[model samples]
Target: MQTSTGNKPFSCEVCGSAFSQNSSLKRHMQIHTGEKPYSCEICVSTFSQKAHLKSHMRTHTQEKLYSCEMCGSSFSDNSSLKRHIRTHTGEKSYSCEICGAAFSQTVNLKSHVRTHTGEKPYACEMCASAFSEYSTLKSHMRTHTGDKPYSCEFCGSTFALNVTLKLHLRTHTGEKPYTCEVCALSFSHIFSLKSHMRTHTGEKPYSCKICQSTFSLNCNLKTHMFTHSGEKPYSCEVCGLSFSRKSAVKRHMFTHTGDKPFSCKVCGSAFSLNRNLKSHIRTHTGEKPYSCEVCSTSFSENSSLKRHIRTHTGEKPYSCDICGSTFSQTAHLKSHIQTHSRIGIKC
Candidate 1:
């Protein structure tokens, strides 16, 4: 028996789509007709094809008929089971024409191809922002609506997306799933783990256009760009003092608010900024991390270490305005200022 090759034997009546076989044309007609002849017995849900109905029925029944012999993992369908088997076998049949990156499934390869093409099909109606995936666009919509649908049962914490909620749950559960293959150092967030990976690989993907300086994280590169632009958007409303980053402005607020959120666990010592708290912790631990190159003297704080370095170098940074006399510290220069005054006074 020979298969028909000259022309398409069947044609769809609804869409005028030609097919090689009558069965393909029949399946194509269901798209335009919206006819779902096959219905699941367990659930009220229906599907266009019997094969789809069979796959849907497994969700209600929780039946995993197809089992992998290598990993002992099971899947509802044979197609999913075949895809899972490829993970163990390292078989990637579907590949991208642009990048040549291979995937086990055609769907995954199609998604990867969009990266090279820069195709953002999913667009937000409220904003002009477009995303590569529908799920990303869905998450972006939450920002405009101020919708936090995902809520934690334990902490009463809310998140815009289910994936963010999943990550937040790890803080309570202490679940660090993303681990470094090199050192087994784990992080709560996937991005944190990716940032930590740069230490091992020495990879700096983010770079500054101004100085050509490289950074491991994109946010670091963003902050570095601000230094070149001399842009301080994050500013204090009261003092008119500005910072390149929001976190810097947040730390500066403690000067007015007198709020000390960061506290030492060992001692009851508190500090406004996290860096101050970290420096205070060294007092308890007796950890002098900053060491001088000239002398073997070590200091807990970096500022103290920098001041100490001037002793070895004999660098007089502070100078008198009236005379050419210089001092190592600012306090010494302030004392010298009184002698220059008509009436000598002490502050």
Candidate 2:
């Protein structure tokens, strides 16, 4: 009756949130103090309120009290059941003010707002890392703990996160839900689709602070950062040679195995890398896609075009360590180094 009459006499001292009962006010105070008195014996999960602990206990008991009539899905709580029903109705009441992105849950809307505000409330205790979402922080903790709780039923493969396990399951199912509107190409992951979209849009959002070099993918930008840091994390087991990127390490392994998997359909020529095969194909088709801006000269390869541009710009990027002599190309630098070797000088 007090809740309906807008009479909440018991007010919180910290947040000024009013409650009808004094017991409810005491539970609400735990939020400000970061206190969780109630804990689950099964999972060691803590909750501020006893009702929350009771709700969590249903997970261990497998006692679902609420059921969705639309899909017959059962939930431990009525709030969870209501959230699940939104999936069928496609109803999103909560919305972001900045981007106008809608979410069914208020918690999701709060999480989305962090993207605009750049707020990271949940911080890692082990490492110097922070996350906007508490769930993301929990996932980050697994990296330090080396925990792989989520496992695949098909392949028996383990993953640190449930979303990663879902992505892995798509490999076995061959389910490509994310589709491109421009090319009709499909991807299993949303991130893969977003990266593929850059190919059509010509967008290079990821940029290196050191060289100002831009990349379409964050992974490519991370690999570019290795050049600045001189960090080679990926190492080949056969040759013991290190590379900045994992793909580069894989390509290096092919040299040791003498495995040329990528073969040209035109001339029966084989290459270790698919990009090399694509460049080799241009030679047969007489396709010179790379063009010079100044002389209008065309080249089959981008590297060749870059070298050609150096001729016009008088830019000698490759420099000799011994004599400090600069050359337009690596081949020119190698030829210059040979001169030093012939003259009894070590380079």
After superposition, the stretches of candidate 1 with alpha carbons farther than 4 Å from their true spots are: 1-162, 168-174, 181-185, 264-267, 283-286, 341-347
TM-score, model 1 to reference = 0.59
**Global Cα lDDT for candidate 2:** 0.92
On residues 85-159, what C-alpha lDDT tens digit does candidate 2 reach at each position? Answer: 999999999999999999999999999899999999999998879999999999999999999999999989999
TM-score each candidate.
Answer: 0.59, 0.58
Displacement of residue 155 (Cα, Å) in model 2 is 2.3
Give one digit per residue, the lDDT tens place, for model 1 in 1-347. 12344588676655566788778777777888899999877667888988889888888888999999998999999999999999999999998987789899887887898999899999999878988888789899999999999999999999999998999899899999899999999899999998999999999998888789999989989988998899998989889999999999988999999999999999888899889899889988999999988778889999998888888889999988778789998889898898868565433
Top candidate (TM-score) = 1
**lDDT of every predicted structure (CA atoms):** 0.88, 0.92
Model 2, position 252: C-alpha lDDT score: 87
